[model samples]
Structure formats: structure tokens, C-alpha cells
Target: MFSPTGEIVADAQRRGVGVGAFNVITVEHAEAIVTGAEAAGVAVILQISENAVRFHDGRLAPIAAAARCVAELSSVPVGLHLDHVESDELFDQAAANGFGSAMYDASKRDYEGNVAATAAAAQRGHAQGLWIESELGEVGGKDGAHAPGVRTDPGEAAAYVAATGVDALAVAVGSSHAMTTRDARLDHALIEQLREATPVPLVLHGSSGVGDDDLRKAVAAGIVKINIGTALNIAFTGAIRRELAVQTSVDPRRYLRPARDEMAATVTRALRVVTLL
Candidate 1:
């Protein structure tokens, strides 16, 4: 059934499990994420990033519609989220298009600016009954720009949530974005501290760089929402590359079918691991 993002996230928090939020770049990605979630019998978040919206020339309706349709049809609970969006217009567009939640990212701005912008966006999002997420600045490798030394302050994270009224907060412990290797070291103690410090559910961005064992530890330490993009993309593109090498067929379905299945398998594994299913 189609679930509200807040409900899904709240359930994860209650169950002490991590909810996997997968980035959807295509219809196939949406289908795979939903199929994988159903297979795992766990609720999942289908995320549409700002860059992904730009990839479709700033038109999010088609992609959002596709994701909503997938969520509606899925046997397991599914929710749609807009991730790492820097603009209010994009957030509004997503909410108008039926996104159950959104992350308003103004992390590049000064602290006060980030708080002000995120607060406004959160207010607007809340008005539409959308769950809101935001991140602290320098949360490690935003858009492939890595500052591994950067870490979010638990006190500041608590303050940010109080000021912004967001439903979730994505913090940096050690992981960086777009990492092909799962070797990022996380601060387990710090994660526990953040969990105690913040009232809202905690989100872990750049989770693709975190290894399986580390991911489990992070969840145990209190990460509720885990955002994964690069790893799934890797699985999908690798499958496509292999399929094309074996067949001369120019049909996109011939290649995309296997790619979708491969991604589904990857998602299923991640869901099982994150949810401890």
C-alpha cells in the first residue's frame, strides 16, 4: 500500500530498523525499488534527487508520477521522497506532484542561512502534510565534494531540528557521497550521541560508502533513514554493460530488463540488511 513517508520512517524508528531510501533515476529504478521492497516485505522510500530532476530538464512531474504509481501498486508499503533539494520551488513542485516527503538542503549556506531557509521550507512542506528532512553543512561529500574530516555536532543538530521543525536530520559521521568503495569509517559513539541529542529520526546520507557491517552498526546506533544511490547505480550500470557485451540486440528493453532485475536484487539485499529481515 502507498504509505506516507513520515509513517514509514516512524515505523522504522519504532522497530529500531533502518528504512532504505533509494534514488530513482528512471522508471526502471522505481520499479526495481518497489519490487525489492515487496520481496523483502519492508517499507521503502523512493527518492527523487534534485540532480535527477535536472536530468529530466527540471520536470519532476513525469518521474514523480511514475514513482507514485509504483508505490500505489506495490504490495508492500512504499513512499516517495524528494532528496537533497536546494530550492523551495522544487520542493513545492514535488509536494504538488504527490511526494510524501522532501529533504531541503541548504547546507552550502552559512549556518543561520541554512537554518532560516530550511525552516521556511519545512513550514511549507508541513503545511502540505509532507515529512521534511534537512542536513547540516559539510556533511561529507555532497555532490562528490568530500571533506571526510567534517562531522555534524550533536548539539547543533538538535538546535537545527528545533529551529527548522524538520521530521528528520541527516548527519555526517564519516561517510562521503558517491563513494565506489564501502570503506568509510563511522563514529559509533557519535551516532549514539546524536540519537540521544536529536528528537527527530536521524538520517544517514552518503550511506553507499558505508560497508554492510558498518551499516548494521549505524542502525543499531540509531540511524533510521539510510540513503543509497551510487551503489544501486553501480549494480544497474554494470548489469547493462554485461548485457550489451553479450547481445547485439539494440532494443532498450533487452538491456534494461536485466539491469532492472539486477538493481532489484541489489535493493532486496540492502533492504534485508538494513531492516535486518
Candidate 2:
């Protein structure tokens, strides 16, 4: 059944487990997410990122509708979320298109500006009856710029959540975006501190880099929402590459089927590891 992101997170909080939020870049991605959720018998979030919207020429309706269809057909609860959305217009579009929740990212702005913009966005989301998420202190390696280490201050993160009225908070905890290596180190102590300081559910973005043991620990430490993107893409592209290398099939479906299956397997493994189900 289709579930609201708030309800999914609340269930995770009650169960002391993390809910996997996988990024959906295509119809196949959406289908794979639902398949994996059903395979694991666990609830999952289908997230569409801002870059993915742009990839579709800013037309989010088709993919959003596709995800909603998959969600409705799934026996397990499935939620749709817009991830890392920076514009109010895009956020509104997601809500209009039936996304149950959105992460309004204003992390590039100054602290006060991020708070003000996220607060306004949160109000708009709440008015639309959508759950809102926002990040404080930009996660590292966004757009290929990896510099001095950046981590979210537990105190500031708590303050940001209190000020923004968001349903979830994504914090920078030593994970970098677009990491091909699964060696990112997370500060479990800080995760616990942030959880203790904030009332809302905690979100961990750029989670593809974190290993399975660390992910289980993060959930145990209080991260309820775990966002994954690159890992699925890796599985997809790797399958496509291998399929093409072995066969000379020109049919797109021939390769895409393997890709989708690979991605579903990855999602299933992640769900089992993160939720320990």
C-alpha cells in the first residue's frame, strides 16, 4: 500500500530501524525499488532527485506518476519523496504531482538564509499536507568539489530542525556524494547526539559510500532515513556494460532487464542490511 513518508519514518522510529530511500532516475528504477521492497517485505521510499527532474527536462509528472503507480501496486508500504530539491517551484511541482514528501535543500545559503528559505518551504509543504526534509551544512563532494571535511554540528542541526519545522533532517556525517568507494566513515557518536538533540527523524544523505556494518550502526545510532543513489546507478550501469559485452543484442529491453534486476538485488540487500529484516 502507498504510505506517506511521515508514516514510514514514524514506523521506522517505532521499530528502531532505518527506512531505505532509493533514488529513482527512470521507470525501471521505480519498479526495481518496489520489487526490492516487496522482496524484503519492508517499506521503502522512492526518491526523485532534482538532477533527475532536470534530466527529464523538468517534467517530473511522468516519473512521479510512475512511482505512485508502483507504490500503489506494492503489497509493502511505498512512499514517494523528492530529494535535494533546491527551488520552491520544483518543490511545489513535486507536491502537485502527488509526492508525499520533499527535501527542500537550501544548504548552499548562509546559515540564517538556509533557515529562512527552508522554513518558508516547510510551511508551503505543510500547507500542502506534505512531509518536509531539509539539510544543514552541505554534504561533501557535491558537484565534484571535495575539500576540507565538512560535518554537521549536532547543536546547529538541532537548531535548524527546530527553526524549520521540517519532518526530517539530513546531516553531514563524513559521507561524500558520488563516492565510488564504500569507505566513507561516519561519526556514530555525532549521529546519536543529533538524534538526542532533535525531535524529528534523522536522514543520512550520500549513503552509498557507507558500508553495511556502518549502515546498521547508523540505524542503531538513530538515523531513520537512509538516502542512496550512486549505488543503484552503479549496479545498473555495470549490468548494462556486462550484458552488452557478452551479447550483440540491439534491443534495449534485453539489456535493461538485466540492469533493472541488478538494481533490484542491490536494493533488496540494502533493505535487509539497513533494516536487519
Candidate 3:
């Protein structure tokens, strides 16, 4: 059955565990996520990003319908999440599209502006029974993410969550997006501070750059929701590259099978590491 994001995260919070929210680009990605969850015996969230929507030529209904089917058929609980959403147009599609939660990205705006936009969106989403998530600052590339000085303040994060009324908050400790490498160092101290100060769950974005030890430590320090996208992409593409190198095949299924299996393996490992039980 499809799980609710708020219910799952709140359960994890109560149990002091972390849940992986992996990004899904295709129906295969959704399948791999659920396959991984079943292998790890954990509940998870399937994230569909704005970039993914754009990649599908501004059509979400197709992938959303496919993902909904995948989640509904899964043995373990699966929650649909809309990630890094910027516009009200897309965010409004959450409930209609079967997404239980959404991450509203207004970090491009100033603090006050971000608060206003997220607050309004949160209000609207709440009316539809959607769990809202937002980021404090820009968790963009290596430059901004790796800068030790450019971290979210504990007090400010608390203020942002209270002001926006988002059910969850993603903070930048030190992980960059789209990183093929998994060596990002996180500030455990700051994560603890943010967890202590904030009223809602703390999310770690750009988590694909974080390794197993850091992931474990981050969860211990207080990250309830971890977003992983690049790691799956890396695994998927690498498997395809290796398969093509070994054999010649025009049929995408020949290559895509290995890619999907590799991604499923990656997701299984991540889910096991982050989930305490």
C-alpha cells in the first residue's frame, strides 16, 4: 500500500531512525526503489523532482501514474514525494498526482521571501493534507555546499520551520548535488544543533555525496529524511556503460536490466545503512 510521508517520517522520528527518499526518474527507478525497500525491509519515499518533470517534457501524469502503480503494488510501504518544486503550478499537482509530500524550493529567494512563499504554499498543501518540506539555504554545488561557513544556523532553521510551517526541513551541512563521488564531510555538531532547535524532522539533501559512515553518523546526530539522487544515477549509468562495453545490443532491455539491478542494489544498501531497524 502507498504510505503517507508524514506518517512514515514521524514514525522514524519517534523511533530515532532515518528513511531514504530516493529520486525516481523512470518507472524503472520506482521499481528499483520498492525492490530495494523489500530487500531491506524498510519503508521509503519515491521522489519526483521538478527537473524530472521537465525532462518528461512538462508531463508528470505519465510518470506519476506509473509510480503510483509501482507503490501500490509494493509489499512494503512507499510514499510518493515531489521534490525541489518551485512553482505553485507544479506543487498544486501533488495531491492530484498521488504525492503525499512535497519539497518547495524557495532558497533562491531571500530569507523573508523564501519564508513567505513557503508559508503560503504550506498553507495550501496542508489544506490538501500534504506534508510540506523546504530548504533553509542553497544546497547547490560543491562551492556552496562544501563551504564550511555556508551552513544553516540552528536558530534560523528553527525560525524557518516555524515560519514556513513545513513538516520537514532540509539543511546544508556539507553535501553537494550531482556528485559522482561519495566523500562529502558533514558537520555532525551542526546537525545535532539543528535537530535540537527545530520542531520538525531534519532532512539531508545532496546525500548521494555522503558515504556510509557519514550517513550513519548523520542519522545518529539527527537526520530523519535523507535525499539521494546522484548515487542512483551513477549506478544506473555505470552499469549501462559497463554492459555496452562488454557487448553490442540495440535492445535497451539488454542494457537497462543490468542498470536497474545495479540501482536496486545501491538502494538496498542505502536503505539498510540509514534505517536503524
Q: What is the lDDT of candidate 1?
A: 0.90
TM-score of each predicted structure versus truth: 0.97, 0.97, 0.97
Q: Write the residue-wise lDDT of candidate 3 on 147-245 in tens digits.
A: 776689999998888888899999989888888888889999999999999999999999998999999999999999999999999999999999999
Candidate 2's residue-wise lDDT over 1-277, tens digit each?
8899999999989999999999999999999988988899999999999999999998889989988999999999999999999877899887789899999999989999999999999998999999999998768866654343557888888788888999999988878898888998888998999899999999998899999999999999999999999999999999999999999979999999999999999999999998977
Tens digit per residue, CA lDDT, model 1, 135-185: 984766655555644588889988999999999999988888888889898
Pairs that collide in candidate 3 are: none
Stretches of model 3 off by over 4 angstroms after superposition: 142-145
The 10-residue segment with the lowest total lDDT in model 2: 141-150
lDDT of candidates 1 onward, in order: 0.90, 0.91, 0.91
Residue pairs with clashing backbones, model 2 = none
Which regions of candidate 2 deviate over 4 angstroms?
144-149
Q: lDDT of model 1 at residue 84? A: 92
Candidate 1 — which residues are off by over 4 angstroms? 142-145
